[model samples]
Target: MTTKKTSIIKVALLSLLGLILIAGVYYAPLIQRLYFSLNIEDEASMPENLRTLHQYYSTHLIESSATPQPFPRQLQENVLPESFQSHGETIKTKAFFTDAKPTGLVIIKDGQIIYENYWRGLTESDTQFAFSVAKSITSVLVGMAIGDGLINDVNDSVTKYLPHFKGSAWDKATIANTLEMSSGVEFDEDYSRTDTDMRRFQMAYLFDKPMEDFLLSLKSNREPGISQGYNSMETQAAGFVIRSVIGERSLSNYMHEKLWQPLGAQDNAYWNVDGAGMEVAIGGLSMSLRDLAKIGQLYLQRGRWNGEQLIPESWVLESTTPSKPYQMPGRDNPLSEKPFGYGYLWWTPVDPNGREYYASGLYGQYLFVNEDKGIVIAMYNANNNFNSAPDWWKERYEDFFQAIAQKY
Candidate 1:
């Protein structure tokens, strides 16, 4: 071959290699997280839960071409709770140093707004991601379905609704078990770098395959219902049971009719849809923080709103009360692990003076309700340190709640 031809061939090969390198870097996990925070709509390869969540917020929560509903207001108050003011200062300091953003914070006491704040360029009008806070919402919907006779009972096997799971490990699991996170399924919830089971699950859900199929593919790590383990996939299984009970309706539509419209939500919200168009019920909901507070308010009033019983009063009480005794499942149970216990998609703090439970999520998302004091506090943060934040924030929130309780 001629020298000139050889030189040209070598240059062409090098150029191709460079292009491939650039693409890999752009698609790396860190780059993906950065890209998702900015251009969420275009990043379609995210976890099915996240992708659906983004689609929901973009399409329904915003006041844009797709959604035209005016924000609704059940009630509004101007007074700032003294407790919230003091706690806000502490949270602000912690958040600034930890590379996290607080999207919104709200406190409701005695049916009046005591405090409200927003950071990170989010306003009362902007909808923020719920992370796993959506799980609590799903839990509420399950209660509603039970009240309406759509769901027969919590003890009913999941196979009753989802027959595809009839022969699987889930067949022996009850709806109540799943809600309590005691389904005994061996699934990992870690989101660290590399190919974890969670990553595999995300890939499958995002790529448009059946979540049920993916779930059934999991092997049992423990005997069914022997212990409690926090597994996001179990929540997805709960969603499947809900879908089975209310066939032919979208999760968004069901939520709209049962909760949003009835509770008079200030804004429309969205649920991320899977490849089969099923809402990613595990943790794919997005809504304004103020509106999110309204959800907590509904529970505060025992599921009653505007002289109507939106959810069964009995169901609400049972759902919030801890079902299991306080104990750790694994050997390395962190001190942050609650000794108080867990309810239906809610976490109870180990406070002896006052009974407090909350809908909690990774990255500092919380909807804390203290029935003893008639207080409901909602907060959203973008912290990624799920393990550390829960323990640390619980203490901060308890202190905040105690100060507020003294006033009442």
Candidate 2:
């Protein structure tokens, strides 16, 4: 080889070595975490991976081997064995079996489980991913934390509970602000943008480690409560704040004692955890179809279960009812939600009618409840068609349920 070529090779080797050294020193832990997580660019697993999310992550068990709440037998008059119509199309067991792509679907009416079905290799005993539907549960936990006096004031600075976030964008943030998605933290929740904050969050949470660190490093896009923003970090931050205040009472145990036991969940559940073993409250909850529906029924009854108020009635009302600028549609605020607005992590209709609300997630996980119609539907799906679906897509899915509601 020529002397010039030898010199060039030596220079290239040195530069690569320098890059390796820097990565090792600065991102050693993250590198190790990613090495255990995924492929190139440390990108999060795509929508396809959602089908087997429980298998992917190290999970913390939320067991319900303790007495599960029994469902009172009162099958609906217009059960699925008969028929239902959507947009003039007759939907039967076949669509739910092969077309609509549901993993499991449960329908409850007037406190009775009228109809239940499972498909896509799922059985009544199987547990499936609830994804962001878990955020609704996190919201419930926050309300409980408030009632428990662990968090005394929603208006107080969140940094008080989570001191590690001191001096950051979250320093002046309040619990209410985070709940409202108005924390103004610079988080890109746009599912379409691969480089957005949500993507980075997925990498840290699902693939890499130390999801909390990524949350703390965030800079403010604007002042707290000034503009609305949505991201998994808001829920994650809330989880941390609650965990810090609650002390050794871990989130998993708290859910079991306060929610699972009280609601009488049928079987055990699991929630995915991060590198530090904190519950991925943003997503990562797994449960059976019936237990998932029971949560909806709990809310439909305004947080009352078996004659007991598990969640405060006031909290349920506040969570279901859209507030402030959200009550008014055609909102032009950059951070304001279009089509429909949000209430306490729960999606609300544009009209602010307290009767309807939903908990939705990627790959077609949904919990749709129409209190006015006395209907609750929990659907688990693997919709290869629209896994990373946009908000408008979810809004349309509600219409499908509206049809079912009208028929019954």
Candidate 3:
């Protein structure tokens, strides 16, 4: 208990506190991101998280055009059907929304809004997270890149643009393969498992780790272009390829210039970025439901918007068509949840007419297009059971969308 010994102990404690303070200061942003990444999908807070995702992550702005195009509202009366058949069972339309937990729903026919609804305190102005629908956005950007001559061809090897991936898993993969989710890069898309690769990828961004590092370090589980497997990392690689070709520009900036502005986006969009400022091309986009419907409407119109061909018509056809045998819809495909075929970041239902395709995302986000009927349906939801939901649930929604299209 000597005075000199007590002073020495006090000095040690103060020095330790100083080091801790320095670490905290250095890691504050990362810690905050990690905290949000972990809690954003909590069952109780998911609705609020969907509404305010831009506030929780670092984002790049996809600015709206000066001349914003608005959807004309027709506002039909009692348009939704009473029931729809799926898996030979008739389900009530009201129960679909209850089960899906939709926050917003907009149905556009012939480029006019026929029905729009919002729940869980969401409004027309709110920009809910698009989840994996951003992948479809990235697909459109890729098509634009090809049309602009920035990218030589979709069949070009990814290493042609990204030299760093020359010896990586993507060495032999083509850009088209990545777009088709056939890159063979091993990434678990399952979100329920904490030990899965998807969880690790989440942690990578939460801790400010370079997403490219994680992407480049992966090894292919199978040969490229053999079959479809839902791998988000492949989309990230595609984003990197787009970044490489569009020199001196971020994906957000490129998308804004080539797609968002040209398409006449009404509201500003937000895209989450990794620590290295790379847009999370897998699933990061956020925008209002009307703007989301605009994406579908554009495709429904064959990639033309207001007399302008924003996306190539050829690309749109290729994006929705499954050319490969493995890409066909059946019970044999690796991830055929509901007998729907795989296209370039899009899904094709088993309709005999073969005119319907859509882009869907985690937690029940959908941007559906019925090309034959000229219908577009945009939906946002916070379904807690998305991971565990039965396969028939999605098919049921598809049937409902088609029913509405037929009714209109």
Candidate 4:
């Protein structure tokens, strides 16, 4: 009787082991993300981690046109001012270089490069990480898709194109909702936390999971449009919708044909891709500072460059200006990524500087455009205080730009 019981136990254990193996294979990507969490905070390797991080990730090259666009040069010999006033203190030009940790700065006024500088082992040619600024790029593509009639309407439900989302809670969410970060999806944007939805996204990406599969696996934490949540996955969903609508066309290729080539980009760009081989449309673009400024110019020019209509003017205004219900969220009931008001993947500040918006990424990548002033400031940094810093740096950059604009 004892020998018979031992044999039965062995059989049960073997069956359980087989089941566990099957489950592991199915959940391998999630497991890998958990494994990758171990190195989330390890001190970055040399010259700056972004440069190396770019080397480690899966990437796709976005080619420039055969004839690159050239900005009319009126290079000012002395680009830096003696000092600029910030928060009641005088921050000298040295502070921007040493303290602010700027890697590149390109100032364009009246459609010409007035000042340009590169540092931190970076050059005008080096394709620095655009980070979240890539979201703005992705936003433009949505506009293009609309303009091209690939996407019928912004108000249409996301499930209209990506049928996979039909049974999901996002079925009712509009493309506009995702663009404005009002999707109400349960995705945490915090990169500092190992268990954050952002890290889970990275893990899924590393493990080669389809971006859509990862996005759809999420649950609806709140009713779509009932609240606003600033998460990368929202834009990821937007990109997925674009991919679904276009079908077989790569985002990078579409960008090359529509904007990169048309705008006459000076250099070829690279967009970070996922293991499933889709562009990381939320925040994975890397390009030279000059080309980034060109993107800014696309907006500043009211979507027209060199007299060619690249992005529609109406779309430009609609995207930057705050839309009601979805975009102009009430402060007392505030739920946003930042204190700043948002409009279609762009950040809008409460500054009394009148109406303005800019594209910002976690790594201090910024493309500031003062449309009224016809000024575009493209600044890139590898700041150590990313997401942990106070609002001072942003305010200081604004102060510097204001001072620079007045001088010019």
Candidate 5:
């Protein structure tokens, strides 16, 4: 063969090798973990819990082939001032939005819709994923279960509902501990690596395995209620407790009857389910940005809507206020970094100057409520990249809240 032909063939081979290497890296478990970390599934829908999972999944994750109806424009058209603009200029210039495009933004003030916008093919009718914000919603459901006497009390041991856990480490963990994220389970929340138990838990939910089985596999790293760790598995366990207490009601059905329909949600929302038809209460919820804003407004009004009480007034107050101290096992708690404390599943900003608390999710999904100023902002973004730096969300959230505070 000619020398020129040999050189060309060698270059082609090297190019092919590089392409394969790139493909492998992109499709590797590490990449999958990154994606899965942002994707929350209903633990009950897992295959091992088939009957429960099937029932939950069918009711929650409804995939309508038909187009979804849009929310009333009047619901959001008058909330903001005519000249008002979001921190869009800052967001566009920032590296965060450049990497992760926000799909939706909705702001409600004084029970009035003010501003709404969508980006990157998302619309007012689209049900954007909630990520970990579902944890906050799950917390609400737990409170509802308590009100209905489906569950006795927050202090009740988890094993009361799931007898299988009677002798297990979680047997003594109380519903309050899980709700407050004080469960001292021996699981890592680290997402930087793919082999961590966090990923394994994600795998369990993704592949539809029993969440309790996954929790049972863990050894106690710390005594229950002694420390705080962001254990997603604990949230799954909380879901199980809710199911066991509520008996036959699917998570979606409960939410619809108790919260959604009552709040006058403009559109149907979807929640991810596990193999056993259990709703993944930790964060697999998906709903329109406007509906999410309505949730914020509901909380802002202390669980009241249209002069009626949807959720217990006391439950809303306690759930939004910080209950546990901000301390982790070996690390400084991020909640301490702020002026506010940690509540049921909400993050209270420490700035005493700002009455702001939020339901924050992986990436940039936030349901920020500033009750004193009567402002509620719901933002949805695909920011899986920001999961590692949760503080990143706090910074932006504070900035936005500060701006809104100025407006009011």
Candidate 6:
């Protein structure tokens, strides 16, 4: 009740308020990232979210080259077929595109842009998220490292480069096993489930937990190289090895030097980084559709660009080929998650000719290359209902791509 006590109480309250304001300012970025991660995707806000995701996450820029190699436009008339076979039924190709319009689609055949279209307000200049297609990008970086003699071989144990993984489940895993999705790491990749290991990994990224720590905590359910298992963590582990072998150089910097510049990328790319500034190698690359197609083009040329071997020819061949029986593509194949066979972070369709392979991501993002036909298709979609969509939807898209390739 005393005047002195009242003034003291007011001062104490003000001091606490000042501390709260300071804390809020200090942790504003983390709070914003958390807010973005926790909210459900509103269809109305999806476009802006895709465009501005870099603002919510830390990122490293992949600067474009001075001499950009833009694909020459030779737009085909009625390039897409009327229909394609899916489950022995003729599905209209136009209907497929109408039902789930992608943000952008770029079809390159014989080093020419034969077909290019945009929907959902996406432009050729606008960079879209690559999602888990980034795994294929990471694979190329690893191949480059091997070619440079920085990494001894694909068969080498991951721990050979990343000593931190020694004595962990990854100690026995080879770089090849990780690339083939055969690391046998016990990770529940079911996205529909909240309690799955994939969700735990996402939480770690959202909460600014070190990705390496989560990877280290994982244990193997089956022996390494036994069968194909889709594990994004395996790609992250390969990324870690890349960062380690390159010494003090950052992964994004190395990517720019080895990949972007060599591919003569027209636009600067963005690789999303975690709290500690480590690139999210499993997913999180964003670039223009043209530039993304350059990835396919590079591999299509067997890693040679501008008369230089950016990635070794042997590495390119090995990356696309399914060497193991368990990695073969089949609907009833017990070893793999999807019907597509696993390669070195690439998807091998069961083609008798051994011509085509692709880099795919969630929500319909794909970088497809038909080597024999000299076709490369780069598609970016905002298929929010992708998880719930019929399994044949993806297969249908594959058939359409094949039809285009055959026509070309």
lDDT of 2: 0.74
lDDT of each: 0.68, 0.74, 0.84, 0.77, 0.69, 0.85
Top candidate (TM-score): 6
Alpha-carbon lDDT of model 6: 0.85
- Per-model root-mean-square deviation over C-alphas: 6.7, 6.5, 2.1, 6.3, 10.0, 1.7
Cα TM-score per model: 0.76, 0.82, 0.94, 0.84, 0.76, 0.95
**Model 5: per-residue lDDT, tens digit, 1-408?**
699999999999999999999999765744554454343332322112211222223237533323332333435333433232233444422454455456677777677666777776677776766778989998888888887878888888888888888767686788888877676667777867888998888767656676667778877766787656677778888888888876677888788777777676767688877667777787788777877887788888888877887778888888877656653111245533334356777777645345567888766778888888888888877654565666655565556555655577
Off by over 4 Å in 4: 1-48, 77-90, 325-337, 390-396, 406-408
Q: After superposition, how far is residue 339 of candidate 2 from its true place, in Å?
A: 1.6
Indicate whether candidate 2 or candidate 3 has the larger TM-score: 3
lDDT comparing candidate 3 with the true structure: 0.84
Candidate 3 lDDT over 1-408, as tens digits, reads 699999999999999999999999988877776777677768878998888888778899989877788889899988789987767788898888788888999998787898999999889878999888999888988988988899989999999999878889898999999988888888876766788899888877777688999998899888887878778888888899899989899999998887778777888999998889999999999998988898898888888877888889999999988888767787656643336777888887766244888888888889998887888999888987887863555666678788887775
Q: Residue pairs in steric clash, candidate 1?
A: 52-272, 72-266
When 2 and 6 are scored with TM-score, the better candidate is 6
Compared with the true structure, what per-residue lDDT tens digits does model 4 show for residues 295-382? 8888998899878888778888888887664465334445544545678888765452555678887657888888877888898887
lDDT of 1 by residue, 1-408 (tens): 699999999999999999889888755644554455444323123223232346422222322223233323334453334323332454343544244345677777777776777765567766666878889998998999999899989888888888878767786888888888877777876654446778787767655566767889887766666667778888889988888778787667778878877666766576766666777777777777777787888898899987999899988888878645433222244521344456788766555346566777666677888877887888776554444545555556545555555566
**Could you tell me the C-alpha RMSD of candidate 5 in Å?**
10.0
lDDT of 6 at 28: 92
The candidates, ranked best first by lDDT, are 6, 3, 4, 2, 5, 1
